[model samples]
Target: MNDELSLPATELVRRTLAHAKRLLPAALFHHSVRTYLYGRLLGEQRGLRPGRDYDDELLFLGCVLHDCGLSAEGDGDQRFELDGADLAVRFLEGEGVASDRAQVVWDAIALHMDREIAERKRPEIALVALGAGFDLGGGPERLPPGYTDRVHRVLPRLHAAAVLHDSIVRQALENPRKAPPFTMQGELVRQATGGSWPTWEHLARSAGWNDYEGYRP
Candidate 1:
């Protein structure tokens, strides 16, 4: 499925990936790729067609760059989602992408954490949150049969839930702005600091995957 809907990487996608690789961790980067794959699958499930309902390249960019805030280059005195969005937009500017397209990716990354709001937006934005939710144990029965095993065989999960959750908690601890109250990062930070949230560790233990080896406690 590396064909990405039977299309090769456009120049923009190539540039986006190159930039993202410089910022994202290996595990997170792979998660980003899987996000695109899963998002595409979910779109197809909902009868949405790429290049018609939305731009496929934009979807790819949004999914891959959605976590840039977790990277040092993208870190800032703001929520990770916002920071990540800003960083992605800036990178897009460097690639000479139009402002409107860049804004789509911005909204996708920034709102991917908000199910209610994101689901109300355009597919370009909404699909991102849905896909991320799916990857994190939502709608497991809805995914196509054997899809997880197939994609994961090519690109390992690397315990993405555990990795992503802990990264947010750690960064939020170091810089409080990154985990402002009411956000997921704030909840994760609280969890790591003896408070509790229904965290990825909880999800992983309950997921029955029996393959979680990241982030203890």
Candidate 2:
């Protein structure tokens, strides 16, 4: 709830929820949110802090909107990530965020799922890595020789990323800024379940949500 980070956070949530409604399966909206939440937690546990060299505002905004494009055309694929990044860039630009800052968010979204981006070790790339728990792949020990030295300079920003992730997820769920789109499948699920939503664990077991196994945070 840092006021400094609130503006971008709000915009990111607003856009993401809207996108989710339009593009995600009604049954998958909750799961998608949970995946985001888990990603935040994983980032935190791995020592990814927020608000340091880079703006925590940018990091928070980017992380929340990172997966929004998944619903742009209604599927989970790399294209979704690309679309989401484009959407975020456009939104931030419209908001008059400095072009540089907007680019940071853009880069973060583009690289969140691409590890090679991390290996390149740019500060922006590192911020995205920390925000998405990308470093959790091979553990700290597996990092290239100079990885620690490079990231050390940006540790505080990393921490800010982690904190922003936690804050955004809490706000989104506790008081969802927007709801999933109304669709036949979503409506049917809602009606059949009496408005009850399944937990991530339940969805994982019943709907084959195993891609994230051992990576949940």
Give me the candidate number with maximum TM-score: 1
**CA lDDT, every prediction?**
0.84, 0.49
Pull out the clashing pairs in model 1: none
- Model 1 misplaced stretches (Cα beyond 4 Å): 1-8, 195-217
Q: Residue by residue across 1-217, what tens digits does model 1's lDDT show?
A: 5553332269988878878878887788878877888888898989999988889899999998999999998888999889999999999998899999999999999999997999999998988888888877768437767877887887788888889998898788889888865577887887678765566667778888875766465
For model 1, how many clashes?
A: 0
Stretches off by above 4 angstroms in model 2 are: 1-48, 73-78, 122-124, 127-217
Each prediction's TM-score against the native? 0.85, 0.42
Error of 1 at 108 (Å): 0.5
